[model samples]
Target: MSDKETPEQRRERLRQEEIKNNIGGNLNDSINKSNNGNLVDLVGSLGWKGTGILIIVIILGYIIYSLFFS
Candidate 1:
């Protein structure tokens, strides 16, 4: 993260970052398979009515925040 890092240090940092990302991706894939596809599974469990209400609430919250802050 520092500008003073040598090339070897940067390379090793990137290698570690890639390893972490690969492990995270594998874990995410396993979880998605078990949970039946992440957001799709969530919306399905909520059903149409619950999903609609969620969207409405999110939109209203955004609008209220914008009105007050911006």
Candidate 2:
């Protein structure tokens, strides 16, 4: 902010400040995107407990669908 700062430096500093201010939103987006990766990565990230729950839900859904519609 000093008068001694060059224009390019000022621009770069402003850009960095803006990026810092926006980092919280970016972090949340990154976490959400991480879960949306390929199937294997998503499952691995969730670990065994999450994988078990996901499989249980799928099996229950299939059972209900077969009973009701087929």
Candidate 3:
């Protein structure tokens, strides 16, 4: 593989490195903390439509795994 990076590649590498080195503040704050910290309502915060799509994708993944391995 070629080892040399273009200008864009160098800039992106530095940007990612900066993000990696910075770790402070409420970066650890949970997004699903509303609804009195209830797991069900936290997921519901994604909206009914988004939650449905997430469930469908998870089911599809399980189906694909079973088809190939079973």
Candidate 4:
């Protein structure tokens, strides 16, 4: 199969590629910052583990409240 892109299609593809590269670069920068002892790095580094713990604590608190009061 032969595939050819029109000029407009090529331009759009390049634009999309640039956008993806920019986002990836920004993410890398944030990770690097976090690795260098920045407090904001805590969030970037811990990420889902921190988020999961927070959710679990909240759920447990809610359950305890319901069990004790109602």
Candidate 5:
């Protein structure tokens, strides 16, 4: 088989590749925005004191659980 593509085929391939890249970029941007929004809401709700308490509780719970169960 010939390993050469026609001009029309090459143009079509490049166009399709461009479209694929654009769609992937747009999807990634949207996902990043969504994740950032969730993070913002979580931080806002927890504030500083709540976050600190949560971390301490989680660490203590982990230690207790590991000691008792695993």
Candidate 6:
């Protein structure tokens, strides 16, 4: 269909085009590509709340194992 686009749709289409045309605006050229990994990036990506929950789950698993199997 060749119907005229609304203003909002035109603005959104233009914004998408702008974003698509902008290359390497947030590219990290210095990042390591291998999976050897960095703990800081891993923990930071998870945020404090997620890290805390992970720690809690690990501690509970350890406690359960110690109480039941040892």
TM-scores for all predictions: 0.46, 0.49, 0.42, 0.36, 0.41, 0.45
Stretches of candidate 5 above 4 Å error?
A: 1-39
lDDT of each: 0.65, 0.66, 0.55, 0.62, 0.60, 0.54
Model 1 collision count = 0
Q: Pick the candidate with the highest TM-score.
A: 2
Off by over 4 Å in 2: 1-36
What local lDDT score does residue 30 receive in model 4, on the 0 to 100 scale?
51
- Residue pairs with clashing backbones, model 5: none
In the range 1-70, model 6's lDDT, one tens digit per residue, is 1368888888767754554454233123112321455756544444455457658988999999999999
lDDT of 3 by residue, 1-70 (tens): 1379888888767754553454221122223355246656445344444456668988999999999999
Assess candidate 6 and give its lDDT. Answer: 0.54
Order by lDDT, highest first: 2, 1, 4, 5, 3, 6
Candidate 1 stretches greater than 4 Å from native = 1-37
Model 1 agreement with the true structure over 1-70: per-residue lDDT tens digits: 9999999999878855654456545344544554756766545444455457768989999999999999
Instruction: Give me the displacement of residue 39 in model 4, in angstroms.
Output: 16
lDDT of 1 at 51: 57
lDDT of 4 by residue, 1-70 (tens): 1168788888767755654456545455555666676756644443455546656987999999999999
Model 6, stretches more than 4 Å misplaced?
1-36
The numbered model that scores best in lDDT is 2
What RMSD, rounded to one decimal, does every model reach?
14.8, 11.7, 13.8, 11.3, 15.7, 12.5
TM-score of 3: 0.42
Candidate achieving higher lDDT, 1 or 2 = 2
